[model samples]
Target: MTLTLSHIKKTFNGFTALDDVTLTAPQNQTTVILGPSGSGKSTLLRCANLLEKPDSGTLTIDEESIGFPARLSAGQIRKIRALSSMVFQSFNLFPNLSVIDNITLGPVRVNGQSKQEAQDAAKSLLDKVGLADKADAYPLQLSGGQQQRVAIARALAMNPRYLLFDEPTSALDPELEHEVTKVMAALSAEDASLVVVTHNLRFARKTADKIVFLEHGNIRFDGPADAFFDSDDPRIRQFLSIYDD
Candidate 1:
């Protein structure tokens, strides 16, 4: 059971965003993607989620595999996408909806869960993320951290096999970032399959089972987290130096 991207490439306006990137995120492990700005970390994650159609590659999620740049039906896309859920750096919640509603919408609308079932699960997820009391509040009423937590809960409601995060805490201050990271830590402890793109070395060191380092749209290193942090490669060392206090 894994999410595999094989020889994936993506470009935008004649600029390459990913170059022959092949990565396999195994089930029940955290794979942290680290790179400098424009390293294609977010682009790779987005490709895995099928938000951007790859110029070329094959995406396989467990038993289902689809080659990109091929004409795909809406049902085909949805079937493949249902295997994973993503939380972006910005909390993309519906402002008009209450917190509980935001979390339940996906499960009810897309996943076809009954409203009661979705709401029941949403309440449990909200409590798990430490936002139970904010259920009736609107997204605009919450702090950034709280909004992000709600985003996490919303992602979880889908019951996806893989949870993809694209710099999930980059918009928050340190204190608010900690609030979201705590929930992520708990999920990691439970051995949820996660692929996270971030510059947060501390969280990566503590939570990542594997680390994939990218540069200039190509993978530079892919290995165990410990090996990545302890690497002697000049590029890896140079990147790590920035996070060194």
Candidate 2:
């Protein structure tokens, strides 16, 4: 399994955010976490990378259990985070840095890769994301969609084993949203092992091998995309119905 979460539970200030959520995602398969707002989709992604600590449960990547970093050293948590790269809804890029610098920054700083080596890798990633020409442009100069694509390129620069997306297209206008989605679709097609928490149901349907529904901080449904499309479950049908109307 590429990822396994067992009895995962998280709470904040006496409120339960996630309760006993369990899931297993296969390697090279796109798994989209679907849910309404505040359904713990983003929380799940955050917990997976140790960005948000789970109150209880085990998270395993590639069958190896992850030790909760709150109990471990800071360096240990960074290592785990490095193994998985997250793309957020907001394009989190340095306004002062050029696109190329944004992409190469982390690998150089955290991985301690030489500047020349990081640049070579960043160039290849930029080409993959169709942003090679925008290398010198700062984040503020690019459109929202372009900045998000640069974020993807930056994540890829780390050469992570898994990719996590948290509402990656939520902040874009319709036209710009399409641009980002097209790039994401292409990437998912090339490598299916992507975990995305998104409200884009169409992208979930088209790109995901498995669709897991979360409601009230719990896994309401987990099955193949076809089942989700068919939506035999009452809750799944009701949840999906919102989009139709």
Candidate 3:
């Protein structure tokens, strides 16, 4: 089982964001996408989740394949989206709703789980993410880390086949970021199928099973995490130099 993007290309107006990018994220492994800013890392992740449809490409999740630049019905779109859950850099929680309500909304509404069932699942996810006691609190009441944890829990409540995180801790300080990254590390250890886009080298080194590095809308390297870090390629070496302490 895998999520595969074949010969994917995307452009905005006159600028190319991704050019003939082909990648496959296998099940039960953490695939980390790394690149400098505006190197098409986020765009690639968005395309995989169908948030930004590729101008030309085919996205295949397991056995089902959807080719872009073709009309897709609402149900078809929903089916594609249901295969994965995404947590954005910003915690996109509903401020008006309580934490528990926010987590349960998707399962209860989209997945058609009963309210009680959704709540039970949400609570279990909350406990797993160390937010069990804050279920009744509002998003505004939580810190950046807490809110992001809630977002992670919200994503998990869907029981998606893949979890996509786009710079999940980019908005927090180091201490707060650790709180969220700890949860992610635990998930990676559990062998959850994860695709993460981040500049956090430490987390990538520790958690990534595979690494795909992009540069100027092209893939610079795709290999095991150890090989990526130990690469002799000048582009990758320069990129890694920036994060070297």
TM-score of each: 0.98, 0.95, 0.99
Worst 10 residues of 1 by lDDT: 236-245
Tens digits of per-residue lDDT for model 3, 1-245: 99999999999998999999999998999999999999999999999888899999899996679888878888877887789999999999999999999999999889999999999999999999999999899999999999999999999999889999999999999999999999999999999999999999999999999999999899989989999999999988999999643
Please estimate how well model 1 matches the true structure, expressed as its whole-model Cα lDDT: 0.94
Residue clash pairs of candidate 1: none
Ordered list by lDDT, greatest first: 3, 1, 2
Where model 3 places Cα greater than 4 Å from the true spot, the runs are: none
Arrange candidates by TM-score, descending.
3, 1, 2
Residue 46 alpha-carbon offset, candidate 1, angstroms:
0.4
Task: State residue 136's C-alpha deviation in candidate 2, in Å.
Answer: 0.4
RMSD of each: 0.8, 1.6, 0.7
lDDT of 2 at 224: 93
Q: Decide which is better by lDDT, 1 or 2.
A: 1
Give the poorly placed runs of model 2, Cα more than 4 Å off.
67-70
**Clash count list over all predictions:** 0, 4, 0
- Please give the TM-score that candidate 2 achieves against the real structure: 0.95
Clashes of 3: 0
Q: What Cα-based lDDT does every candidate model obtain?
A: 0.94, 0.86, 0.94
The digit string of per-residue lDDT tens for model 2 on 41-100 reads 999999888889888888888634764434867876777777789999898899999999
